[model samples]
Target: MHKLLLVMVLAAFALPARAADPLPRATPESVGLSPERLARIGAMVETEVREGRIPGAVVAIARRGKLAYFEAHGFQDGGRSKPMPRDAIFPIASMTKVLTGATLMSVLEEGRLSLWDPVSRFFPAFAEMRVVADGNPDSTVPAARPIRVIDLARHTSGIVYGNRGTTPAHQLWQRSLGGYSRMSGGDFIAAMAKLPLLHQPGTTWEYGLSIDVLGLVIEERTDKSLGEAMAERILRPLGMQDTGFVVPEGQRGRYATPLPKDPVSGQPQDVRVGLVTPGFEGGGGQAVSTAADYIRFAQMLLNGGTLDGKRVLSRKSVEEMTRDHLSPEIANNVTLTEPQLTNFGFGITVAVRREGGSDVLGSPGMFSWNGAYGTSMWVDPKEELAVVFMASTPGLIRQHYRRVVNALVYGAIAD
Candidate 1:
């Protein structure tokens, strides 16, 4: 059958990208964490796998600039025949935003862009934007201010994603934007410009196509693909060898896959991304990376944008990126609906906890973010900690593990 041959052809190109060298290992206590308390994570993740919540997961933590806990739980596939590799590649969806944001900072350092630079500066299509008016699908109001580079970083751009909710505005986005993986950089921008925004630009802390637009900005400003700009600005500089827009030809064997059907939602969940190349690299959530490589990226942020003397960003830029960019009047959407995010605020492509109001256990100033496909990483400057969680599960459990991992890791803090 044609379908069968297509599968075979795709598999032929799917084949092995190994992770970069693992971070230096140390006993949990050496990094001021309790070995016994950290073992609780193993028990918790095992239960998650046994319950069929996830095909597999990888948890890696670095504190005091040393790797303390590196673990892989469950099997690589639904069949459970093969063990999950600690360095298994995963579709680190939204986690790619931080990389894109950081790359844009490199462009910023070179004066190609500025935080206040309007999106229309790079792509004029972003200028004549409209917002849904009177809560009506057919209504429109011009954005009070142009969506800026900073707005995109902090997700206040008001450009909404099509996947969530069935509101008229959401439907408009869904109907207008299709086949994104097939769109060129310019095509993607043109499609987005055609859709009305969910909120007035800079008025709402919305999580949506803002970063994806930033991706196009990166590609345009650097005159290279988003993937190439990211490699030059963050991946290569940080020595994140295994992270990229496409999983190399022979590296498909290392790609972790999701369950055939969601155990909870029962929808077919096929999150094995990064097989073929997209027409334009998506910053919203398209990169595949391993636990080892992703943690390195997180560690770089924790180290104030440098790792082992490789300066991916200046210290002050990292500070600004991690700080809370939202004011109290800014209405938070989608992510803020969660009780755990009550004490949090949006930052450049990540979330920053203002204080300790959430149910989750973490330091007061921890900055973190997760992917739709069950990947999460956080940097706690106060704790000198960076933790990366990679998995193939999606849906409700993605945020669930955000709480679970933070509790498990912070609970193990011995000092």
Candidate 2:
């Protein structure tokens, strides 16, 4: 009898304790945030929707590894008929760069490539690149040096989106866009090589197609498409099941929609229809994700590059990626049309606090980035916090939404 009792006791002792939920929920007060203040975030978003500024939004906040608040406001379309679900998928756009950055860091951790490696190492044509002078594509000078891999990650590669400004490089970029959607990764790189750079590599910070080039680099290094590489390295491991370059037909119901027309421009808002599958998956943009999925990604970074005991990157790699990689000269030269008061990191934006005044609110060392659509996220190491704000408004109004969300989220911190 004693033997039987001993056996039962041993079996009970050997049983594992209940595993914690993958994303545990908690109250704002329990997480050192105020419930009343956090509600203001919803209130503000609600007002924006009521006023017809944005169609709808999903705002999520997590602190100290616990989800404190997550709410959806307004409708998925301008008609105010279809309600927005908390899990509605929105086009993450440029926010895809950070995921690409993380995927590249995973490759870097494997010693497959170095940040200092020249772009010519993968594409030899980048070695003999030229620079256009004074908005004149006709008057060009030989590039002093090859564009480095780091230059692409940090937007220092002098590659600009032709659609952005009116410059020689801009015009060249505009011309290149005509066939951008049809080109393979190799063809895209070849086309970019033929165009003169806007500036010498590592000299200036021009937000452009640099990350897209980095995406091609990943494909060259891994012998896989960018989407495939990211899935193997980032999405699957992070359990971001809903995030990808394409939303399947069955999942299309969850896709968010923007207003029929741009609120400001009064033109039809260019909405992404169907799957965004391309010959080469763009690292610059063209990805869709949900707030829940992205907050997990953000939490992984906030937790020092690991989440749920899975190590995506080393703490050192996270630090290097998030720290301001821009030189003072380059930073000073940054003239963003948006109201972001921040500096560029490798693939994210680092919010630096000025002594006298600033446009946005939050602690310094806050690392973040936003999509061209109304999607923004930030990981505040100081506050031990992360926030993901997702919407589908595709216009300059996104900047205002980002700013308002930032201010309201910061103000909600009772602690």
Candidate 3:
């Protein structure tokens, strides 16, 4: 009898305690946010929808590890009949860089690669890359240094986007666009190697295809496709079931869509939906996610790289990823052409507060990034907060929603 009692007691102690919920919902006041102020967020979004600016939106805010606010406004499709669902999936374009960054950090944790490793180490063709100066293809000069993995992570590799401008680099990228979406990772790297970099590596900060190159590096190091690697390293661990390169058939109804024609220009916007499995997974901007799913990703970082006891990255790695990695000149040399009032971090945009008037509202240490298709996310370590805004518009109008959301979120702080 004593042996049976002892066995039962040990078994009881051995049973794992119930795990804390990954994200617990709470009232706004319970999380130090005023419900009245948070209502303004929904109002602003509804106003935009009413004015025919955006088709729909999903906004969510979490403070001190509690979901204080969440709302779905407007319609999921271009038509106003179908109400937008809170679980609506968005084409989280460049926001994929954040996931790409986290995946690379996971690789770093496993000792598969180092930040200072040169791009040529994984793909030898990058060793022969050249730089184009004075917007002349014929005026190419050898890069001063090989593009390092850190250079790619921080956007200093001088790999500008294809549609940037009429520069020689941009023209080359535009010419190479044919193979961008269809080519394999290896082929894409080879094509990228043939084009000239916009500037010398590790010198200037120009947002471009750097993350895409890093994605290929991750594949080479892990012997897995980007989607496969991300699933194993991030999505599965974090339980972000709704985020991936392609949405399943059943989830197609929740995919958000913007107006076919621009409300202002009446020009047909190029809004591409990723319903089918992609042949090539571009790490730069080819992923879709819902607001709830992305908030879990952001919350993991805000919780010091662990969500519900699943450690995706070390706390030290999260700090390194979020800290400002730009040089003084690059951070201060703001021009009309470059990103204003912000600094670049590893795969994310770090918001910096200037002394005078600023373009957005947030804490100085807050780090965030957005997608071309009207998705925005930010993590404020100071406030222990994470906010996600999702829509489908793919133009400059998304900027207005960003500003309004930022104001409403910060303005709702009650304590």
Candidate 4:
């Protein structure tokens, strides 16, 4: 009689599920992610939380097609103005390159563009390119080779952000006050054409407006704007609802504030709203996304360009997109020499699986990149893992979050 009563009591409490714990499997034990390790990651990042280095941050990691861990720390704004939510929107800065690269790869699959095709073939301005001789501002020499789409993808096209020493190209941009940093499509192409090339094509790796220029090339070939092409080819296909150059009116509330180092002024908030002009030309720097939204895109790449039954790229194309395309000699200049980092692949930065570089359990062929506004992500195909870290602050502050998160996520992989 006593045993039967106990069974009935358990059934009564379990069957009438309360809203508090409706889904038991959503818990760590049911999903297989070690809660202890997840807590450790939170604790590590919390150190920054206490120091007030950032207003807030969101970190999400996925393994084997499942969300292994998702957590938020700190406030979405300073003074604990708003609690950080998991679905908060971030500008995603140059992390836009990954999506832009994916769009190019899809176009390549459709035979609209070839990696080796010279940019001049599509844009006449690239026809008479010249390299800045001896780093001289006025000196110029003809390019030994043509600028190829592949070179742009790998950032080996000799294009750099700021020439730093008043080179011809640099002076022209400064003189014109041209917005190469944010320019897109035809105008962007025109501005680049008027300026001199920084170096011979494929001669060195420098991070600059290469991807933005590639966005123009896509526009020229497709005859449609970069926004439309990316929407039809990449965003819609991935079901990345929140991923776009502009945020919808109703969804604008989800976007987080972007600080400009003034803790009290609160001057430039919500970087996505008024700063980035919404159009086809902003593809390289205009994207806004949430952690959940980007994870789907990353997972698609991990799953051979298909996610949730949506196919975006062929297996061969995916492999080609992630492979390192730079020559070994030029790869050394890809990242800052002080960082002493890895090489650059076609559209993504490659981590050469060094034994001592990062103790994380990433695959030898892992490739990923970050945005200028503190958004960083990486895909380790060999390990079948994808991690996306999104935040709203700018500059090298992202380096700390990138390192700490990777250490915690990869360390808990249960190798």
Worst 10 residues of 3 by lDDT: 13-22
**How well does each candidate superpose onto the true structure, as a TM-score?**
0.92, 0.91, 0.91, 0.85
Count of clashes, each model: 7, 0, 0, 1
In the range 1-415, model 1's lDDT, one tens digit per residue, is: 9999998775553322224345666667766899899899988889988988878788898888888888898987766667998878888999998888888888888988899999899989888998889777688988888989988988888887776667888887887765677788788889888788888888898778788889888888889988988988888877788899899989788888887888789888776568888888999888989988888888888988888877889998888888888988888763543445667888888888887577777777788888888888888898899999988887776778888888899999999
What stretches of model 1 exceed 4 Å from their correct place? 1-21, 334-339
Q: What tens digits encode model 4's per-residue C-alpha lDDT throughout 1-415?
A: 9999998865543323223210111334333457787788777756766766677778777766766666677777645578888878888877787888888988898888789999999989888887788767477888898999988887788776663435556666566524554443566677677666677788677767788778878887788877788889988887677887777778776677754463334344345532346534554566788887788888888888887676888888888888767665664454562142443334442323332443344666787777767788888877777888887766456666676777787767654
List the global CA lDDT of all models.
Answer: 0.83, 0.81, 0.81, 0.70
Lowest lDDT 10-residue stretch of candidate 4: 17-26
* Model 2 lDDT-worst window of ten: 13-22
- Clashing residue pairs in candidate 2, if any? none
Per-residue alpha-carbon lDDT of candidate 3 for residues 15-97, written as tens digits (9 for 90 to 100): 23223223677777767899999999888878888999899899878888877776789999987779998888899998898
CA deviation > 4 Å runs, candidate 2: 1-22, 331-337, 342-357
Model 3 / residue 274 / CA error / Å: 1.6
Cα TM-score of candidate 1: 0.92
Query: What's the lDDT of the predicted structure labeled candidate 1?
Result: 0.83
For this target, which candidate reaches the highest TM-score against the unseen true structure?
1
